[model samples]
Target: MASSSSLLSEEQFLCPICLDVFTRPVSTPCGHNFCMSCITSYWDNASFSQCPVCKEQFQRRPDLKVNTFISELASQLVSLQTSYCDHSRVLVLFCRDDNTLLCDVCSSSCHARHNVVPVQRAYERMKDELENTEAKVQQMIQERFHKVQSMTESVKQTAERQADGFVSDMQREIKELQRTAVKLRELKQTTDQLRFLQSYSSTSLLPHTMDLSTVSANKHLEMQHFGKSLRKSASQLRVSLDEMNTEISRFSGGTAESDAATLRYMQQYEVNIVLDPDSAHPMLCLSNDGKQVRYNMGAGMWAGQFLNPNMFTSHLAVLGRRGFSSGRFYFEVCTGQKTEWCVGVATASIQRRGPLVRSSCCGLWAIWFLIDKFETFICPGVPVHMGKVGRVGVFVDYDKGEISFYDVENATPIYSFTECSFTEELFPYFNPCDNEFGSNLEPLTIVPVCHVE
Candidate 1:
């Protein structure tokens, strides 16, 4: 019976506004009890000063005095209820390893070997972190608000400028229309005068038709001027847009590093090109993996190896199984070790049986590797002296009509064939030229491009 009455007494000390025990208990003029902070906040928002529970009015706002007795009683109740370790001891320590609040009993038991710290220290650390996070959040919100305001202002300015330009264009058109109307009116007056004169006197004073070529010439001139102005404005706008894009790229990362970075990025689309033995010459021997090919000396001894119509009779070359008719693609070939080789793209309709003409008109665009120099097959072959390079990188942009070759080892550009009009699908062509007495017998290997970093 005594414990039940004590619970009811504890409820009376709780602030009705907060539903919690009062920190600084206070009394109002109407004899209502509440926490000082809670009552002050309520009065600040209230339309009139009155008791919240009874609706009894006060003539004037009264000064609130702290009820010291209630405050002491609330504190004692809170301490007794929240005491750690079965309410016998206060939680004054924190176990770092266990990540738990600890009293004396808890510290000596499960957390005896763990690192311990004062609870107050942990509370201070957490409080500091929370405050810093709150400050950063507020700063972010402010920055976004400013950005929105700037964007709105910019939109408004653009709208006004466009409206002004529209008005100016409309006015110019109206002036042109007015000038044309005046010319028409003058011509009508001249025709009326000529008709009146011809009614009485039969003399050919005016021409059979009105000569409006002068007026037409003037109108044409006006139209040309308008077109010029529009073109000028568009060109200026394009220049400004380009400038803004450059500024934006400065803030972001700039374009890929000239050659090396571009090659690295292109490696994502590196394709697996397998050599087709059916399209290979009898003198050429392909590796089992199909990534490499070499010229065999046995072709000279046998003279006739395989009599197939699909085999290359003259050119010692092979075509890749995969073909590309559109878009972009890249592949690499190790041509440094080999003294003689030919690598490039070839059209599907190229003759496979008869004597092959290695020319652009004959559907072959390749860089022929000789003993000491590189020569591109484009009619009268052009010699390219890019020094001795090991690996060669080939990049083909079919839609752009460009085929470029690069020295992968030195990161140097070798040559590029531009403005090529391809009619059929192109296949990767490899020709490890005939073994010249075993001197140029090194195989041309296709190197797979992969991510380096």
Candidate 2:
């Protein structure tokens, strides 16, 4: 009987309900053993009395009496498991310094000078510490969860408000179009030519003429803007969740896999950016594919070049062909070894003639790098300090009124412009600042985004 008991696994002495060594073990009518308190609590919480392991139902709750034999076996198992050391000596103390259970012989010899405590005392202290840590972690999780939920609700409310406004505006425009249609029909049916001409001449068609192309474009733009905003909100939620996940992983001794998730999220909004030749200054030359632009060595050679109204005449800069009025967009530029360069987003309507102010108030949101100094184009140029970077990333959330720059190579943020009010279409702007005797001759090249897996 002793040998048979020795062969029993620890699992055999564990209660199914609590998954711990059975306390006051009780045998149910179904022949299953469980701790008396565990089974009682389980039944009390459940609608019906049933065996947790076997799922067997009982018509009436059975009176639970401790099974003496099983209770003794469980107690003995627990005692046998924790009462001895590897050398088969009784464990009576714990070495606080080494954080290990120790037998009488080992405690007096190996742990003689170490801080020691009774095994029971150490167990109680450690258990309390663990419980406190777990409680703190649980509280943190709850707090973050509430924050995420609040942010999600806020985004939903903002989107709803914007959607309502968009719908109202569209409805108003539809009503005006309907009224214009009725008037046109009435004018077409006029009996007298003079009356018809007079009605047509008196009524202006500029506001009433509904251009299908323009309507389709506006609708597409609006939907795209709305969709991008939703996507941005979702991304923000994902970032919050990722941060929570990282914290949980830290507590659980796991690796954080979300380090690059934000950069990858931004990459998802990468746009196909190309330089606009029409908007390029005469001193700047664009590549055939429009993916690159550089300051021309022969700056004054293009004397007879057709000057475009949108061209940057004074600054050696160029604007991207594709413009964004709403929604999020991201693009990367290779500023490899360039001593002087500027890259960012600017309003399409920014002054192109004469010397232009390179600042937010002047319709520009850009970062300028000269030698080792970096500054953002804000009136007085706020300095940005960061490591030397080879590639630069520009991200614009038009509706959110934010433009952020990142060091693409290091996947780190360099600077950001937030709470900006942009009312016009924004174009990606680049200035390969003057060549400076070939010191800054490298072209600014737009590169395709490569997302992290």
Candidate 3:
């Protein structure tokens, strides 16, 4: 037996295939060394026989022989063994740096944000994003796979035109390409799940807080007193809750306390807008609450302008998470002389501060904070997806060359901007344009049914 240190140059003796000292060396017909399985798999399906290493033609399989000298030497090179530290072989460390989790203490100390998890359940809740990313990867891969196979078939068709009998060969390759497409899709699906590691490892839900320093100190103290008075009625509020539950059950049970008359949901405001440079009167309409307004522009009231340099026509969004806490704000409109101007989002109160007067070639129009600030600017050629708040309507002042709103949300074109003085309205509106047009004012109405999400 050769001494471990006297085994000659380890680098020279290494097999290129496995990047290790050969375990069982077997010389091929052309003198290439391979582990038995590696070489056999290489030649198993090939019809034309040739040495994979040297490309030497072999008429038939040669007598195989095992070289025992190298095999015995490989057995003597024992595998390495190790053990983990007693304190933290299976620790879940929190990283202070990234607020993420680390399995080792070394990582926990450096990453400030990392929170150590001693239990597997720490990551259990965070697995959804990982799974979602995995799913997205699979979906994107499937899309790409179809693209690749389509391209492959196209190329095959072109190739078959020049080569005889290639059509049949191309048809055979088609099936193989489809299988490859599926494999590619699956690869992407799993690879995208890596982001899941950081999400669960470092997630922390901190409590929200706000200081009551917004209003004047005197007003703030007054509000605190008012808040205390409100809290005093907490017991009374509990009693009211009981009454409300009784009323709800009574209504559901088809029993009336006194008289049973159902009331329709009411609109707080009605809306209408027009760009009449001359004289135009604001129309009054009855709201759902049976209240009337002179000229209330609906949520569909929107204007198209070059808000961005590229002019992406984003919709008039009512702010607030789910618009839960939104109130009315002011808006300012700035028209362009060259038909290239910028419209930015500002509190609708900002527009009200200025005198509502008609200015130069630059035109500005705004509705005071009567309702939530509607982000009603539109781009020449841009499509938008107004999420959640389904289909909206918009009125177009075709003659005065301005878009207006007459009806309320989910409006099915209650009015149109007729030649003399007509208007239209809809809700949750977004208009997309492909190219710019001078004075090409337009309106957008999304289909309510299409709001799948």
User: What is the per-residue lDDT of model 2 for residues 224-255, given as tens digits with 9 covering 90 to 100?
Assistant: 24454544444554454444433332122111
User: lDDT per model, in order?
Assistant: 0.62, 0.67, 0.30
- Over the stretch 1-453, how does candidate 1's per-residue lDDT look in tens digits? 565235645576778899898866887867778886687678778888887777887886665656777777776676555544564676777766655667888798878899887776655554454345434433433333333233333332223334334334333433333333322222222222212221211122121322222222122232223443433444444343333322221122222223444455445557888999888987788899998898887755244644666677778889999999997888999864666788899999888876786555888888887765789865434687534567888878786567877766544567778768887899999988875623777888899873321
Distance (Å) between predicted and true CA of 249, model 3? 51
Give me the overall lDDT of model 2.
Answer: 0.67
In terms of lDDT, the poorest run of 10 residues in model 3 is: 257-266
Error (Å) of candidate 2 at residue 52 is: 64
Best by lDDT: 2
Q: What is the lDDT, from 0 to 100, of the residue 400 in candidate 1?
A: 58
Model 1 deviation from native, Cα RMSD in Å? 35.6
Q: Write the per-residue lDDT of candidate 3 for residues 246-317, one digit (tens) a residue.
A: 232112222121111100001112132222111111111222332111222332323432322222123222
Q: What is the lDDT of residue 55 in candidate 3?
A: 83
Clashes of each: 0, 0, 52
